[model samples]
Target: MSGPDRVAGRTALVTGAGNGLGRAIAHALSAAGARVILVGRTLGKLEAVAAELGGDSRVAACDTSQPAEVDELRAVLSDEDVSILVNNAGIAGPVRELVDVEPAEWDEVFAVNVRGVYLMCRAFLPAMIARGGGDVINVASVSGKRPLARRTPYTASKMAVLGLTITLAHEVGEHGVLVNCLSPGPVAGPRMARNFRLEAERTGVTSAEAERAFVSRAALPRMVTEEEVGAAAVAMLRMSGLTGADIDLSAGMIGR
Candidate 1:
């Protein structure tokens, strides 16, 4: 089975589905025949995505960083057979040096990027294990494995996600669950553009120059796209043999 056949009849819940990678993933999963659940902090944004999906797809509002909100969301989704869980909710912490980063800022980043993944897994993994199989895709970043200047909290949180994915896979392998993560490079989006602008301000260069410097490290010398990330998620679902793997969709950044 491939393409739509791979995910047909499955329910996929994607966090941060209002925009960026999450929105793209929701669209991809829906296109692949999965009943998608658009989850995010903004109800209006989710509703917009839900309308765009225009099918059995639905929207739910919840702050993944908050345990209470996650618990409430789990209860609301208790009746759905969510076989595919995409823990895509994350936040870019303060773009400043480690010393300048406030303690609360660091904690907030971990709350969404790390603790959010753990909470979602804890809420849904039992049912998946009981069902004898499931798929989990934790969205991480290449920055997790590399040294990114002035991104201490986001980098650290993503690295934690990588560890969580692999260790969780090991523990659930016997039960037939597959867990993996995508460590994408600098994707071409508003997020990256903002980062580029900030970098230009910090490094005394034009935005284009800052972007060039960032992508020059990659063998392909370009950022990935949101659609590409979505397609990668679909491909991961199709490949049953893959588990405990960190797929680097970074335009050969890791290779270089």
Candidate 2:
């Protein structure tokens, strides 16, 4: 469990495994020989990723935000000993002035980004502790480290994740569970494009301009690649010395 396959012989449960960073993490872990459980909302999308993974990897469709769904998901995984848990499922809520955003939309954002991660931990973390040492990597964002204009809900939810990761790390480290957060900046994907479009509409600037602004804080400003995010995640899973800390993969983005 400490070589090229750093997570070898461990079972990893990754949420939002349908695409983007989540997919990249799943691929990286599976390539390293971890038994991967792909959990997401869409079975079809999970199936597609499962096919791409094809090994001992599996698909379990669940909405991380729903209590009942999370319980069922835990039951589905009860038989398999999960040694790694990656909470990557999240949603970018409506981009608008805080006052302009609907309360429901704001709540939904927290439901998925905050409560969802909470539920997953609630279900799987104790089992890992009871069995002995394990790892939990929570995917956060650079926005959580600073304020982002017009993306209040997304920013707030990510901040909550940071806090949760830190507090949980403190609580679980004694139990041999290491919890950490990986805060990536502007990971290139359809999601980033959508965020740019919304920011453009908010600022009356072009989406292209919004993209530049999104990475303005990066000393070496650029879009973060999916492969880089994947590698960072794998690194986190491998590192045993760090806990309750956020590993920033934001291309030197200056945080406020």
Candidate 2 CA-lDDT value: 0.89
Best by TM-score: 1
Model 2: number of clashes?
Answer: 0
lDDT of each: 0.93, 0.89
Model 2 agreement with the true structure over 1-256: per-residue lDDT tens digits: 2345458888999999999989999998888778899999999999999999998799999999999999999998889989899999998888778989999999999999999999999999889889878899999998887778778999999999999999999998888898999999778889889888877887799999999987776877887888898889888887877799898888888444
- Cand. 1 Cα-lDDT: 0.93
Q: lDDT at 178 for candidate 1? A: 93
Candidate 1 residue spans exceeding 4 A from truth: 1-4
Question: What tens-digit string does per-residue lDDT give for candidate 1 at 1-256?
Answer: 2243668889999999999999999999999889999999999999999999999998999998888988999999989988899999999989998999999999999999999999999988998999998999999999999999999999999999999999999999888889999988789999999999999998899999999999999989999999999999999999988899999999988864
After superposing candidate 2 on the true structure, give the runs of residues whose Cα lies further than 4 Å from its correct spot.
Answer: 1-5
